[model samples]
Target: MHILRELWTKEIEEPDVKSSYEYVLNLRERLDDTLKIAREKLEKARGRQKHYYDRMAKRRKISVGEKVLVLLPTDSNKLLMHWKGPFEIVTTVGINGYRINMGGKEKTFHANLLKGYIARDQDTSQATTDERPPTSSCAMPAASVTVVEDLEGEHFNDSDCEALPELGGWGSEETVNDLKYGDELTLDQRRQLEERAIMYSSIFSDRPGTVST
Candidate 1:
């Protein structure tokens, strides 16, 4: 039975031995044509998939001495991963790989497993400066004065400093006014608070190398 052709219809005719041979040869040619078409479609599909993947993938050109975070597995669990290090790129290993200074040791990493590290302090300072009200300039720069006074204190300890008190409500006119503290506190109390803050100002300081042991 010629299953491929006969399955569609009941009407059938048995071929002569010579005719059967020709039919088998014809089927083989048809199969080769079908296989070629199948292979072409597969190649086109692979090309389309590659094009979409390239479009979605992130491309970064990391330079030497630039800081980047690396994706790595945790010590406790190999399956669990996290971004670690703001490690400096010592050199480029290859087209998409970087050699990082993981402390004294160097390790090569693929670019896909690395991302640029941006220091938040600079951005935070800029954002705060921009968002500050114009009237704040007119107000007594008590914090700036205090910071300077704190720097002079030789006994100031970062470990002694406490966490900053949270403002009850943020971004309100009252919150801004309350931050001045001058109008709210008595003269003696304000002086004491300033002395306390100055004694432990190392924690509050944004300056590098300010924290001493």
Candidate 2:
């Protein structure tokens, strides 16, 4: 089943609308069949799943400012996001619906809607060993942030770089000095370089706003 899902999802890339719908339908049917089998097996098996799920109490109320995913209505597909923005609940619009404020706009939806609305944020601490592995991509570094970072950067001394790494043993000291001195910038070249630096830095002496001035 996983191999089939991987092939349908990762291997196939994005199938056309028709294919995706058909594929999702097939997946749900398969999942339903698998669950049915599991349930029947549980009934006959010596061991049983815990009654924790049965003991859980249903929450009767939801309120304002809490973040929640809108459970969508399968009967209607008029809404853009069947599951969308973590909308803040404006107020309880009764058992069938809720008045929600999403992205600065107030909208309402039925409480009996589609999927992803949790009564409260699920406890991350309740995560089991079989839950997803730590995703490396975009995961933040596990380090305390340094608040007083130097903006100008750690000082890099020019004197250390001034001593060339090698003396270029192929040439005498005088010969190398002559070669470097011969390549030194001319006055015009130096002035042009200084102008370029100023231009790149977007710095110039104060002048009247008018170009002619």
Best of the candidates, lDDT? 1
**Regions of candidate 2 where Cα sits further than 4 Å from its true position:** 1-60, 72-82, 114-213
TM-score of each: 0.46, 0.24
Tens digit of per-residue lDDT, candidate 1, span 71-162: 99999999999999899999998699899999899999999999999877987899999976433112232223233244343443444344
The per-model lDDT (C-alpha) reads 0.73, 0.57
Give per-candidate clash totals. 0, 2
| Model 2, CA-based lDDT | 0.57
Please, what are the lDDT tens digits per residue for candidate 2 over residues 1-213?
Answer: 654666656665565754766677788999999999999898766343434544574544665667677755445565543566577878876675778887778888776552345564356645654464433222223323323333363443444334323332223223111222224889888677666755644233222233433
- Looking at model 2, residue 7 earns an lDDT score of 61
Model 1: lDDT of residue 35: 100
Q: Evaluate residue 96 in candidate 1 and report its C-alpha lDDT on the 0 to 100 scale.
A: 94
Cα shift from native, residue 181, model 1 (Å): 48
Q: Pick by TM-score: which candidate is best?
A: 1
